[model samples]
Target: MNNLSKTTLIDQLTVEVYQNRNILGQEAAKAVVLKMKELLSNKNRIRMIFAAAPSQNEFLETLTKAEGIDWSRVTAFHMDEYIGLPASASQRFGRFLKERLFDTVKPGVVHFIDSENSIEEECKRYADLLSEQPIDMVCLGIGENGHIAFNDPPVADFQDPSIIKSVELDLVCRQQQVNDGCFTDLKSVPTQALTLTIPTLVAANYLFCIVPGTNKSEALKHTLSGPITTDCPASILRQHGHCTLYADDDSFELVANG
Candidate 1:
């Protein structure tokens, strides 16, 4: 349990298991940097969407320290945002990314979901931006309830007609925010959010899903071994040819044991 313990394929998804969260984060960051370097070599710029959570801390920290990626050639976006959180709130997804990633790398362009605006207008605005060009990559995570972004089980749609939409956060999803310490309590978490749809996320050329911690073990197991259904939104990754799910001993245990 001191290094990468396993690498296997499930459907079109690649699953990598490491000894612990630190190793998992380092390995995932290395792979992401390598892919970024390769893509930047061929293209002038790349657009990427990222997830904001305590779970992403190690990976984002390591990624910011990596070399060879031209930050000036990158445009950054976030996968979701609370519909009512003040823009200045530390719990805001955009603010989290700003402090942890964007502020450090300073990507050429950073697009934040304008939660302060009308939900309808904000969704349309973000969707239009996402539609302007193909998303090169997406760095995300799985929720305790098997959600991707804010696409909780209750509302996930693999074939969502819209690029981005407003959604009511399910109980499990909101509790996860408290569990992650992003909020002091479930009631403090916003009940609704704006999220890029499943289709939009899976449309990215490359998907790097970093999920760690024992709290996520059950969800990770369901994602890798359970049926591909909206009930487990993360399970949809199995159908994406270029998606990779990274997990540590704690999170991968249930899947490994099965």
Candidate 2:
């Protein structure tokens, strides 16, 4: 991990490309864990939000294995979920995070967005839960269409008035779900989802964006090179003083070359 190369995009964001997703996740887990521990030294509790996706598997696995931290004082939250998925469905973002980290480590509190309930009430409920305190950090990834969480370009708002809301998924975002093998086909994917708006995600004191695979090369290009606008939702990360984007070799080749 120490041998991983580092580069700055526009001299505002720090980009580190690891050899592969495995090591990339491991190193990212290390950094986030260290930051969590540092925050805990000054505070009694810390709240964290996680993005559920195959891209986050390595990081979550390594994070659950990290020692010397008290899980009881940490609260967990997930970024988004499909609106129509069955409770027992493995594709549910809540179930995904539970199996990955929540169930393994047993955090003090785990708040999940209940899509089965009223979308309006669910949004208010989750938003209220998040507003109880400032978020310490967010562990997330960039979608193929350059989205953060489910904040796809169609609904991403930099000055969103609400914290969480229901949004229609863009074609590229829906396709990425199938591309990631979360669903059998496009028809099986949910068109609507509950997502934390851009303002909510960026409100965290720190953000760790873990993106891997060559499949993300085009989006990563736009994220690093494009203007800071909702057109490339993840591009807003450039304005955060404490955010870091981690990519693997294949995912960052284009950015590294240019």
Q: Which number leads on lDDT?
A: 1
> How do the residues 1-258 of candidate 1 rate in per-residue lDDT, one tens digit apiece?
349889999999999999889989988999899999999999999999999999999999999999878999999999999988777798999999999999999999999999899888888889999999999999999999999999999999999999999999999999988988878998898998989999999999999999999999999999999999999999999999999999998999999899
Off by over 4 Å in 1: none
Tell me the tens digit of each residue's lDDT in model 2 across 1-258: 485966565546778889889989999999999999999999999999999999999999999999988889999999999999888998999999999899889999999989999998899899999999999999999999999999999899999998999999999999999999999999999999999999999889999999999999989999998799899999999888889899999899888777
What TM-score does prediction 2 earn? 0.98
lDDT of 2 at 81: 91
- Clash number for each model: 0, 0
All candidates: TM-score: 0.98, 0.98
Clashing pairs in 1: none
Give the poorly placed runs of model 2, Cα more than 4 Å off: 9-11
The local distance difference test score of each candidate is 0.93, 0.92
Any residue pairs clashing in model 2, and if so which?
A: none
Lowest lDDT block of 10, candidate 2: 3-12
Residue 30 C-alpha lDDT in model 1? 92
